[model samples]
Target: MQKFGNATIEILKDETLSKNWYHLRNITYNYTNSKGETKTLKREAYDRGNGATILLYDPKIDSVILVRQFRVPTYVNGYHGWLLETPAGLLDGDNPADAIAREVMEETGYKLRDTRFLFKSFMSPGSVTEVLHFFAAIVDATDRVEEGGGAAHEDEDIEVVVIPLADAMKMIEDGDICDGKTIMLLQWAALNRASLTQ
Candidate 1:
């Protein structure tokens, strides 16, 4: 085992499990507790890289723009229908802001008037190394420059949906909007709608 003096955790082994699309690795590490005890642990982590998501809110209309698309993971987990969610995409090699701007244009066809950084979070910290940067943008009809169906090469068949903010909240209550990042963004919008409009 390699030494990591004064560090709480030390990576002992990081072996690639798969890299077909993203990356999966089986990692072994040594964890040192506060009590001066040490234990070895092994865990598999799926690293699809970090991502970004945004809530497109139009204050003039008191509405938000969203998308519906199929997710194979959700489908295999028993959710047969498409998922309603905020526009999001992997950062790829771009920074959070740049990546989200590209994603919003590709997914919603909205050239945002401005974007406000809300926060960031790990959608599935236990297993997936995907830190999602959340943002909110104010947009209007003029921002729509295209059909906004998603990138063709990614095989994304997305349907754009525009609805009142109230209806979106109700969708959460009725269990229709179940995506984690989308739910978080919606809640943030609901909590800050007034300030956002101003």
Candidate 2:
């Protein structure tokens, strides 16, 4: 796609909205449109730092390691039960690769030695400023060094699950798996199954 000319932005006012859990800001700005029209806009942006997620595939068994946990945000938004998702966590001051490696171990007990960085995305661009890094790694039974659940002091309660790739994809179609990052990584694995084994 051809690049559209940049829109000019002038900050009018910026204020902290909240910081109980993460940082939230109310920003007012002047936006100059492509047609040379200027308009004032106000928006609230939530910043929870950044995060990382990983898909641990066991090619030997054609399965992947996943986690199930209760998410208050999703529960209030309509989902009433725990969500099945790729092992993930906030960077918490660490870089994406190191953060994901630690997260995978904590969430699934899988020690990732050859994690491949897939891509990065803004999970919710309209209101959130979190950029999530995606990764994948090939794993087997030998890689699991502990009985993974979650960090206790952080009030995390997680259940580790291993399922075949085909079943995982079917869950997505059946609405059983609704997390965006999980679905994206699963789809990527499906499309690149051959290369992943190489």
The root-mean-square deviation over C-alpha atoms between each candidate and the true structure, in angstroms, is 2.1, 2.6
Clash numbers, per candidate? 0, 0
**In candidate 2, which residue pairs clash?**
none
Q: Which predicted model would earn the best lDDT?
A: 2
| Per-residue C-alpha lDDT of model 1 across residues 1-198, encoded as one tens digit per residue | 444565488889999999999899999999887667899999999999999999999888899999999999998989876999999999999999999999989988888778889899988889999999999988988999988899999999999999899999999999899998988988988888888877
Residue 87, model 2: lDDT of 97
lDDT against the true structure, per candidate, is 0.91, 0.92
Estimate the TM-score of every prediction.
Answer: 0.94, 0.96
Measured by TM-score, how close is model 1 to the native structure? 0.94
Error of 1 at 181 (Å): 0.7
Which pairs clash inside model 1?
Answer: none
Candidate 2 TM-score over all chains jointly? 0.96
